[model samples]
Target: MTAPLHHAGFFGFDVFGTVVDWRSGVARAARPFLQRYGIGVDPFAFADQWRALYQPAMEQVRTGARPWVRLDVLQRENLELLLARHGADVATLAEDELADLNRAWERLDPWPDAVAGLTRIRRRFPIGTVSNSHVAGMVQLARFGGLAWDAILGAEMAHDYKPQPQVYLKSADVAGVPPHRFVLVAAHNGDLRAARACGLRTVFVPRPLEHGPGQDTDLEAEDDWDLVAGDFLELADLLGCP
Candidate 1:
């Protein structure tokens, strides 16, 4: 029989769409850069375009086509490609401007339920981020979004990205919990599937608008995840929290 989620020693959350509203945050941060280049593109579309490159970039490392690279570096490299692809004059920007723009991932705002829900869950279990972001980026994001994480676990720590068995196994080790004693809570089914394969418990929280309007994927649990909740607060309630 499946044990109650609260019985798990800790929960590792997926930060991007699960905790923080990355689309809004990235769009907001990218606006000034677009304006500076006289680019009249829809910022949200631009955000989506930038995000589309996320997995492909990580796959290079997962497949060993590239050395382990920090997510920040991949993000910056993707940003350059996105700007040029979207017709923004990348050459017009100063180096400092580019650097500041690349830090957008560090300033995302948390979802309304994130801080309070995590706070409540923390009373019963240790909570930390298991994200694809770099460790430094995750720390800055937590501080910026008021997320209280007990530890920051990410690609940088494992020197690899998620869906990789090593990343999930290493995260369990870092959380000081047996694989089965840990839960990976994410809005992405692929992520949950990978964790499940590694013997970790799974919870699916749907972030329907994670990709903005016309979003279709991850709207519901694809597999029989241990728990499926509408949001973090509901998840806390299902796990027997007050």
Candidate 2:
């Protein structure tokens, strides 16, 4: 198999589905809150419901319909919307409790291959998260998951969300790497497409289960990404990381 591209000085990752299992992570975190409210709905479906709003919520900011807002704020707003749509009343929950539940975005667990792959890749090049997640959230995730990120770069830095060229370019800038010298690894084709547009090399790592069993998109690389790997460890192996 062809080796993973190694010419880049740093690798910027799409953290949500690429490095961490957001479906499981969000679902798991929501379970306790649901149980406390005695809501019997599937937490997994609830997680999906919350995630379903992600792109559109960010699009508001991207389109300038809304001013720049952190991912956490967007998440909380969307959570309220989901609760209302589901007919679940969280009005009984204290404000801090509600906020803590929303901050569950910070505790997402990494994929099985994530820690090892990033650890190996870090030996050869600096690694950072270029996710649409907020900087504080990314920092919390790194600490919680032992991700070992050299820098946290994302929407918080760009003041915009992914698919926005500034987000990708801002990651490279924050990592102190030229756009051409940075590689972006993501499971979503749209993410890689944006990165590639900004002159960054791209690696597409398919997480077919990112949206859970019913997922249909991003199952394979839609474009000829620079590298396509089964997982981060495989990506590291292809990139010749020891």
Candidate 3:
């Protein structure tokens, strides 16, 4: 890996699926249920369904049909669907058990390099997450991952989710940096595409395993992204010093 990059006025960073490995965490947490349900399922299927629920839920808020809800709320909502479809009675799930499951995002495992890489990068950038997560979820995830961000920006604060310029802009606003100065680094090409569409500089870090096993990774970065890295540390090097 190369030396870290520095951005004097950069604003927010992202949390899930970026700094940490969210799918692995979820799959690990839900394994017992997956076994108990006796449902013929693969780990990636659950992860994909969980992510698929995100956009539709956000569309409800974006279209103004449903009130703004945090990603955690949406995850729990979708989790209920997962359980029901797999034969678990929602009524039988205790509140504590459900809450623990909902907090799984907060407890995500970081990439092996995440903490060290973020620590090195934070010295030069005012890093933070521009996520659709609730403050509680983001904070807990940051705490768990040992991510040292200067701020945590969420779509919940904006009353909407990403793929919307507002969520991206909100992070810039919260971090007190202009959109151009902030670089969105992510594993999802779709998300990087959104940030690029909004005129923000972007870095693509591919997590081939975001979909779990037997899945193909997002190997290509759009030509327009500022840079693409094998990992966050390499991304840090690619950015270079001020």
Candidate 4:
């Protein structure tokens, strides 16, 4: 096994599927709203549909076609689209009800190994988020999942979304680490690729079930990442985290 890279200054993470189970978490949060509205769609499918809109929604901002906005705003917009697509009468829902449903993104539960693995890794190096989630949402999520982060550095800070060089570059800048000394750990290959392009080291941790049982994408590393771990625990072991 390769020894821990003590020279690395900071470890940044991609939160959604890498640190937390967004699909299951969103599905679980959507269940009550679905039940209340008598929406017969499977909650998981609803979650998937909402997520499907993520990239395009962000792309509008990434391309400067729309003003930069936090992820919460994008998620709320996506939720409305999801409700309309499923034929749910949005007019009947109260503002708080919609807000609560949208806040589902903030209440995600971490994967089984996430907390422990992070705890172990943090012992050796400072850790923070490099996710696209806004600051407020990331704080709530960390609180909900008992995630201990040393800093929150991502889209909100960069005013741009992932796969955008600014997000990775700005995050490393915020951490005061040179791009090459900063490591990005993510489950998605595209995210890793982007970080690598910006001179950040990459770690790919495959989450085969992130999209659910029928998921066929991001099941393995697509390129030669600096390291690949099956899960957080394995990642911790690879990093020689105590």
Candidate 5:
């Protein structure tokens, strides 16, 4: 026999593609690099490549091919890869400009419903971001977007990136909640699948624009999540108001 689910406890969540608009931030960062130091390179393509490279970079850590590198190193690795792909180099840019680009994740705009959804969740449950993003970046984003988090949980915190069970399970410990009492809200299906594997409850909300146009997500709600919503508002509806 099973017990009724507790509605009030703790929640683990994904922030990069979940609460914040990573694509918009990335695109904005690309334009400046393209305009200035991109050196006639296809920066739109670079941004696209940069975004695409995220998972594989984290996967390197997850699979033990690389050590527990933070998201900043992974982003830098992807940045250098994109530069190499175009036969360009980073030496052309001032150190300041290069460092600024690394801060893009810090400036991600929150989704329309993120503030409201998180605020609502906070009334009842402790909420934290379980993402591959660096701690400093997520902290700056919270300040940038006015997001309220009970705690910050990330690859930087756990020292293990996502798709790894250690990273996901650590969310509950970081937020001081039992694993079963927490829910992971994420936009990416792969992310949600990982949380589901950890015996953490899950809610999926679509970030259709996370990759901009022509991006096809696994829109099919998997059997894993306890709830699937088109966006954060619908998630709130399913979870009920605090």
Candidate 6:
């Protein structure tokens, strides 16, 4: 049997996909940009392809091949590559226009239950983000989504990305909680597995539509996690929140 969540001192949440709808949000933001460039690709496909570069871009930093730069930098680099691949006339775009398009990540909407569920859970325990996003981006995303976080903790803080032990350990350290007492709530099984290996309890909240309608991965808990909830509302209930 799993231990009660009340015993945990801090909850570290994975922001992208887990708390927000990245695909739909990015696609919405990309639609107009694509049309302006006369690109005929599907916006959602563009979103997916752009996202496909996320891990590899971060991997460069994680492997020490590149210095620790913010996720914003990596994302911008990836965006340039994606734009080139799609035959967009990148040089013709004004700096502000390109930056605004990159800022789409900051403007994502939360999962329908996210804000309310976090509010309920926050009534009982401290909650914050353990995301790959930088501080500035996270601040904007929180403001846009109305996600009231107690703190922002993750890759930016640790100078590394997810599945990296330091990201989880550093977040728990920043929260002033022992690794064993800090619970990580994430949709990705690999993320939870990594956190658990670092001594944090894991809660898997699978987001089936995070990758779009035909998503085949992370649809359900893939291991015997500390807890598995269908969504944040259920997570709040399991946590004994009001």
Which candidate has the top score in lDDT? 6
List model 2 lDDT by residue over 1-242, tens digit each.
Answer: 24336468788999999999989988988899888877777999999989999999999999999999999889999998888777777586668878988988898889999999999989888999898888788889899999999998888889999899999888898888889888999999988888899999998999988998988999999999988899989988887889
Give the 10-residue window scoring lowest on summed lDDT in candidate 1.
1-10
lDDT of 4 by residue, 106-146 (tens): 98989999999999999999999999999999999999999
Collision pairs in model 6: none
In model 4, which residue pairs have backbone atoms overlapping below 3 Å? none
- Evaluated with TM-score, which candidate comes out highest? 6
Q: Which segments of model 5 are wrong by more than 4 Å?
A: 1-5, 41-44
lDDT, model 2: 0.88
TM-scores vs. true structure, each candidate = 0.96, 0.95, 0.89, 0.97, 0.91, 0.98
Where in model 3 is the C-alpha error above 4 Å? Answer: 1-8, 34-44
The lDDT ranking, best first, is 6, 4, 1, 2, 5, 3
TM-score of 4: 0.97
Q: Give the per-residue lDDT of model 5 (tens digit) for 21-106.
A: 77777768877776775456554566677888888888888788988877888898787777667666667667787778878878
- Please give the TM-score that candidate 5 achieves against the real structure: 0.91
Q: Which of 1 and 4 is ahead in TM-score?
A: 4
Candidate 6 clashes: the total is 0
Give one digit per residue, the lDDT tens place, for model 6 in 44-98.
9999999999999999999999999999999999998999998877888778878
Instruction: Kindly list the per-residue Cα lDDT of model 1 for residues 1-242, writing each as its tens digit.
Output: 23657579889999999999999998998888788778778889989889999999999999999999999999999998988887766787788989998999999989899999999888778999999998889989989999999998867778899989889889899889999988999999999999999999999999998988899899999999999999999988887676
Query: Model 3 over residues 1-242: C-alpha lDDT tens digits?
Result: 12122443673566677778888888776666567556567665776777778778778888889887777778889889877886778887777777887777788899887777777667667678888889888888877878787888869777788878888887777778777777788877888778777767777787776666666767667565677778877766655522
lDDT for 110 in candidate 4 is 91
- Model 6: how far is 151 from its true place, Å? 0.5
Steric collisions counted per model: 0, 3, 2, 0, 0, 0
